[model samples]
Target: MRINVLQHTPNEGPGMIEDWANAHGHPMVTYHPYQFGHLPNADETDMLVILGGPMSPNDAQPWIKQERTLIQTLRSRAVPMFGACFGAQQISKTLGYEVTKAPAKEVGWAPVYRQSTVIPGIPAELTVLHWHEEMFEVPTAAQLLFASERVTNQGFVLDHRIVGLQFHLEPRANNVREMVVNDYPYIQGSQLNQTAADILTMPVLAANQRALFHILDYITADN
Candidate 1:
């Protein structure tokens, strides 16, 4: 499968998702619009993977607008898509849902509770990496998949093909370290934010990776 990755920034790349793709012998083509200033056409992509970034979808930046337009076209084509954090917010906004600041910021490892049993292989609760202050409402056409203490719309699935996750299930230790180094300012004051030491010490990577694989298999499976 040709997985097209939409990387928003240098720090937040595809993380373990790339590793998973490589291990499965799937070729991944990445588009760095933050540096390249352009996006790939939807017809050239088999599956779309949108990575997390620090930017909010509500911003008026030119690249953000371009991404929104591309996401709209991909949605219309029913392209299988997976989004994380900021990417999720983009999908929600494109689907006519409001993306707004959350009551509190979630910036560390936290438990996400499953709201539905439609998707297989995911447990009822799993601790995933989070680092966003903004949240998106579940679109009307989608089914809510997960929720957390601070965010009601942690994850959703649309048409059994498109998936959006508000948390970072793809991040491994290296990815977390990069994020911590790049966005260190947000890792303080808030009770939900964990220290770099604590986050690095967590043994949740294996579990999270397993869940991510299940999600990938589910989305890529033929109905």
Candidate 2:
């Protein structure tokens, strides 16, 4: 299977998702449209992974608009897609749902309670990294998968193939460290924010990798 990733920033590249793809022997490609101003063709994408960024989906930038169009095109084709943070919001917005400011900027590690068992092997509750100021509403007819105290729309699974997660489950230790160093300003004012030292020292949970791989496997599996 061919896996295509839309990475918004150099620091937010696919972490464990790459690991999962390599271990399974699935060929993968990552596109940085934010820099290159181009997206993968829909026909070539068997599975799509949209990684997070500091930008909002609502931005009027040309690349953002193009990304949304590509997302809509892929959805119409029923391609398997997994989006995180801004990527999630892009999917929601392209589906005609609202992407608005969240009640608060949720940062650092927090527990998200599972609302459905659509994806097997996912724990009822899991603590994951959050670093978004905007959230997407679950698309119509989609099942909400998880929720947290700070954000009600922690995740949603649509059509059994599309998954949108507001948190960072695919981030490895180095990924988290880079995010902390580059995007540390977003963590300062929020009550849920964790200090740089704490975030850097936070232990990497094995369950997070398990949950992420489960979702990836389920979405990309043949229906």
Q: Which candidate is the best by lDDT?
A: 2
lDDT of 2: 0.91
- Cα error, residue 219 of model 1, in Å, equals 1.3
- Which residue runs of candidate 2 sit more than 4 Å off their true CA positions? none
Instruction: Judge candidate 1 at residue 193 and give its lDDT.
Output: 54
Poorest stretch of ten by lDDT in candidate 2: 189-198
- Model 1: per-residue Cα lDDT over 1-223, one tens digit each: 7899999978888888988899888899999987788888878887889888878898888998888898899888778889999999999988888999887788888899999887788899998888888888999989999999877889999987888999999887888888888887888865585787777777655878888888888888872
- Residue pairs of candidate 2 with colliding backbone atoms: none
**Which 10 consecutive residues of model 1 have the lowest summed lDDT?**
189-198
| TM-score attained by model 2 | 0.98
RMSD of each: 1.4, 0.9
Candidate 1 TM-score versus the reference: 0.95
Off by more than 4 A, model 1? none
